[model samples]
Target: MPIASEPGPGAAPAGADPVPQFSEWRKGVAGVLAKVRRVEIAELPDEPEHLLDETTYDGLTVAPLYTRRDELPEHPLPGAFPFVRGGDATRDVHRGWYVSAHFAGPDAAEVNREILAALGNGVSAVWLGAGERGVPVADLPAALSGLLFDLAPLALDAGAATAEAAERVYAALDGYDTASRKDIQVCLGAAPLTSRFADAANIGLAETVTLAAGAVARAETVCAITVDGTAFHNAGASDAQELGASIAAGLAYLRALTERLDIAAALGQLTFRFAATDDQFATVAKFRAARRLWARVAHVCGAPDFGGAPQHAVTSAAMMTQRDPWVNLLRTTLAAFGAGVGGADAVTVLPFDSALPAGELGVSKSFADRMARNTQLLLLEESHLGFVQDPAAGSWYVEELTDALAAKAWEFMQEIEAEGGYSAALDSGLLAERVAATRAARDTDVAHRKTSVTGVNEFPNLAEPPLSEQARRADRIARYGATFEALRNRSDTYLAEHGARPKALLVPLGSVAEHNVRVTFIANLLASGGIESVNPGPLTVDTIAAAATEAGAPIAVLCGSDKRYGAEAGAAVEQLRAAGVETVLLAGAAKAVAELEDAQRPDGFLAAKIDAVAALSGLLEKVGA
Candidate 1:
């Protein structure tokens, strides 16, 4: 299962020209960049490479611009070796990817109803969550009682009970009247390694291979093992880490399966699942990279003729927010679009309210479920996104990102292999450590607003009514906005106890035009933490104390231009303090309040790029929320 290191086919030969035909274009772009710097960035000291707008993600640098000079020298066509473009040479324009719906159940009847509703509407596949967190092993038969086994493929996630669940599915299929069971696809979802890591469930690898042999004996088109990356993704692994881990797991399964079966047969028994996020370009590149990485693995195993890696893309659960749940619709739509365009064989969009408590073991035909199903349907039928194969094939950015992501993932896989494979890496805590590091970095970005979660960290609506509570499946994901949501939760509790939300007074030190920007900034920041902002507009220094006293706010923030702040902020803070405002803050920078006398200076400052979580948490604490 160890792949040899070698340069990819697209690598440039020795002494080849790196930037053919771009001299004139480069000069023109340079001139435009210089003009931009001169006109807009005159205040900042210029640097040699100041004009470039590069960003990095998962250790890959994304250049501001790409040209033919940046393109790889060669790219294999669709359905060719190392199928980066796509696994299929052609796809049905009417139906590009399988519309897969996910269901979890402890109740068979409820699961059956959801499955039927999904299939009837538009879903082409069913991903059933079976076992302890999902359907009971004994209830599999009743859960899938009326499902058409041939028309709708079944993928099971049974954790420790995978073997039993597969047997039940086979038993149910035994009663089918179809002449060829091979027409139906079944993914038995056996991942001993991932299941062990995520749920501490020990499923035997040898037993899983034995089940695959049984499936092959029955001439069933069955994928006995699923290398699911969502477990790692939800645990906060970056895209490359998730891909590398998944590939490593797939290789491990292949080695075990190959002991009893040939290379091609073992290949047939495996499938992949990846998480698709709202970062559309990254999601597309990640899936495309997955295909390329596995194709290389297949080639190394002497099975170049294997069709492609079977991929099932699920919208990222880690990106879903509990505070501003409605915005999840847009996130899932973008993610689903990316998955489809990236050539996922099947795509699953989790319900918009998936993070909320639903009072059930599985999602049913609620409005959220219907919306999730219809989102994919609309992409296929209305948007006609399925009308093309490898829609991102020729874009320079996508191609470059695909190559970069694939290489990074391959490097990660090699690291795991060097550490004695995935199991040893897990045992030694190497895998968890790396994932934790990435999660920490991501959490820092969210806290500082470097990464914005709309409706949670960005434009939160404090007045929005809460969704009704229901029992929901237990999850352990570290959601990006969970910290901000915690503050909102405390605000909710305060509201319930005190009969009103905590309030902060906004003391504008000048006219509306002079203070509008800082005023808006302070107001939005307060709302994100569920605190109300009481703005007594354009208060004079003489009237500010009375306004603060009348509002009965425990805290007051001074908002105005830097000039206005220097002119009147010290006096405003003094008056606010006299009026019993427990704390005074300036919305401008700390330097604006630095010249004031110690007694007149505000307690703190609020400005851009601050650690929003820490600031909001402190505000809540100051107000006794």
Candidate 2:
């Protein structure tokens, strides 16, 4: 699986000119970088804008960039002393990544319908959004039978509060024949240990992973329990806390799974799920570090032979805003790019309107998915990002950052171990206490302007648009939860509605404007055809700034070619009060749009595709804001 070596029996192996051709020190296995030949960085030293930092999380220093690689001890390659890249082999998946779509609705039939839709459309895996108490797929067989994609779509996640509930869910999935249906695929998640767990509903989460591994294929089901970093982030977990606590959670799962299934199965079945938002580089670096640490953990557990662990990434919920739901597509696109580049085996880009009410929104829902998928298409077919593996493998900053992440996570893991292992640490409230402390710090930083959320803290939601969505899932949940008598007894009252303002502007950035031009025309067409319409003048620093400042409506249809975007645009939107806009979109396909977004910057990056439009409209209709 190692990407067939050079033409000849290793014809001088292409790429980064053999180190011996330039340096002598790097010739040995795991040789410490004696010299790296420092060169000028267009982004570092002289750059006015700052990307790295020395901030702290719960008093722990959060590495801004990576640490000096030469300063750290070295580990062997995959299957060697460290196994960082992966285990022996078999991990080098042909190309692209496993696909996925999440289902969270209360209705069994409706959620099943979504599963079928995704499968037919090309999703290889799924994450069932069971409530705190799981709804077993076994409880609903009709839903699973509609698959149009591959057979036995992986049954990885079935969330429930207790072991009993999780078992029921798995029992339902295990009903399928893996040989014939391959439905045995699965990973049941345990709810996160929240700040109020001791008194609240703390159930057997590790029990679920252990139980699933014991019953299911030892090779499949990810043995790791998700930290639900996004769940914590949504509840206000700080960056470092999200990172630290997740690392701790991962370690806990490794130890626990190893206990139940042994180190071999624990390492083989273990995988990590992360949330990627608009923080492009951070998202990338986070995964890189995660892979590094996971390998180390396997080694530390005496399972040094375990290869690459699966890393599945989903977009962040905390970052998705219900107000400007259309922008979510753009946000997720960059997140997807970060995950894919960071080496995730699977990536799920949520519909932008996810934060919104639900189905009540406009059809903009499809737009989000289309853009997400098409963005990958662009990266693979046009950008050739997938042609090579670990494109960022040798970046000085990336490598150093990866090392730093590994070190930090390892440090935190040690701290957790000191607290009597992850589970004991959780039981003692260490994880929650640490996260709480970090959350407070992050809030302070945001409030004090040490950190900025473009459209949130700084750019307040100034102009409130009319009702754009209704409680979509809430309604569905009600439908499912409501019995005949309950429905009959429930109050039925309706109120009059108001109208949302209509206006659209196309702002395209970059020197090569072909893609954006098409997107602009599409945006204009969508607007004229019924949606609001406006075209910002050709993308220029002055024009973008002027339009951003003077724009009246909550939605600004911003467009820019990949080449045109960077800190300039980021700077322009850096101060654009988060309050003013509902949607800050990049008017083009995902390929171009993903490059346009920087969570630290101003605009939503996405193409004006019909699905993207539908997805945005879905949010608007759902929230009715």
Candidate 3:
């Protein structure tokens, strides 16, 4: 496997199309090609290698151990210079974070019911996921009277508001007169460059932040201008890139608003949102790194203290796979755990049944909001992960990765600095290219088997039923937000442009049956998509038997799961071939497929326990039809 060649100690990658010139550098200075030494000896118990221990979000090759004592590019202190450890020595251990869940039903009464239920179930804040324009309080006083506990129902959007509408939202809530106004928060969803491509919207997120921060007396209440890191995460940003972009966004808003309201006061209301994906360490490292990164930016921006602002994290909708739906809970757990460990002020996990709604056109499904909300409560109370701080703190690998990420991100930031900064980089399409390249590389690795995801790429059951919308991206308000700068105002258009995608005929072979032919099946499947295959006929066993006989073989092909492909499976292959058939293929692996091969050799055989995609791709090649 996976090997770590002493990471880039000097120049660029060796095979970079046209190599960098290194004719006049010091010996071992810019052209050192350190030999990769895996084992001083592999049989030793003390030196067993772990493949995952050395990988990183940026694809950097890190050693098994790195530390503060290790040679690192030096930086300044926390809250003083570069702000690596953190900013201002203070950290939040306050009754640990609000569980903010978004809720929207058919109307106010229906919506109020969800809000009240959430408050009852421990959701401290409520985000009214896009499409509702006013403070959802129709008869606000009555709604408050009914609730045992008070809740903040926040609205979201990305556009300028008329003078009247803004006043109406404030008045509607004021008229409600709930004692919990002390805890109630309102956010004007005006995030900057949230939609850079939209030329006409007078939506200045910084302006809205200033307006609300200046007016509100509920010092605890937020007039938040969200900087969603999820947008960049889903678009394939490495943990460092995601953190840098978020820092820049927060700074952009802070630089604009500190002129009006004090910087700390404005930042206090800002919510930095991120997406928690399946890669737990990366997710954990992301939030912690984000905190450290933001702390630095805040210090540079002249804030005396740079901690305590809320970090809102949502489990990524992108990482949820449609193929083993139940495995989604495991994925969500890993991601949510990362968010919690990395110090999220709040975390939300999307239900296994979210995509059906987030992807709907015109009729957004509300299937998972309640489930998503409950996920946080389940973790907060059940898992009890709240009992620690920077949990992975000093572990050699984590620390190394953390420092490595900071340095790599700083390098990118320096380049941006040379080009006038983050906004300029985004405008020039540099950001998109960077994230896209990472995504393509990862996707290619997954497809090729270079990176094996257990239930996904490696051991997959071809006979298993295809998955539906049981799991999906937590519902995102599509195509708007600074993260959507490249995609805004054109989601539907882009979808239209790439319309009518590839169609695959998924053959669901019930648990196991003799009718199944694993290799030919996959090869045929692959062939339908324009790959080549080595079979013909009605995709039936009788036809396969006939072909075997014609090929002058005394064995036939039989394919099915272990349950069906027992010892008799070989016997049946022989019986069919005696009647003029020639090979047997078992979709199930393990000793069963091998046992059949040991019993007697068929002309050719291929078997798989999982991997419908690869199998199908292979099968498609065998039979053109």
Candidate 3, superposed: residue stretches over 4 Å from native? 1-53, 62-95, 132-169, 176-183, 195-202, 205-220, 358-371, 452-625
Could you estimate the TM-score for every candidate? 0.91, 0.59, 0.64
Q: Write the per-residue lDDT of candidate 1 for residues 194-232, one digit (tens) a residue.
A: 876676574688899898888777766888888889989
Per-model C-alpha RMSD: 4.2, 14.1, 12.2
lDDT of candidate 2 vs native? 0.52
User: What TM-score does candidate 3 reach?
Assistant: 0.64
For candidate 2, lDDT tens digit of each residue in 1-625?
1132224353345553523333332232113221232433332333211233454453333343332232233334433434444333343334456666766555778778777776666666777655443344444444455543234334434444434544554445555444533323454445444322323344465555656465445333434344455555554554444556666666665655665677777665555667776777667777767766666666667765673566778877766654435656677878888877776777787777665554545655565555655665665566766555556665656555566656676676677779987678777877667656655555445433345443332232324233432432232111111121111111111112334334455555555453456554545333321234455546665566466657665555545545554434554454343435555554544454344455644444444323332334432443342
Model 3 deviation from the true structure expressed as Cα RMSD, one decimal place: 12.2
* Candidate rank order under TM-score: 1, 3, 2
In model 3, which range of ten residues has the least summed lDDT?
479-488
lDDT (C-alpha) at residue 531 in model 3: 27
Q: In model 1, where do residues sit more than 4 Å from their true spots?
A: 1-54, 200-202, 359-364, 466-475
Q: Which run of 10 residues does model 2 get worst, by summed lDDT?
A: 485-494
Candidate-wise lDDT, in order: 0.85, 0.52, 0.52
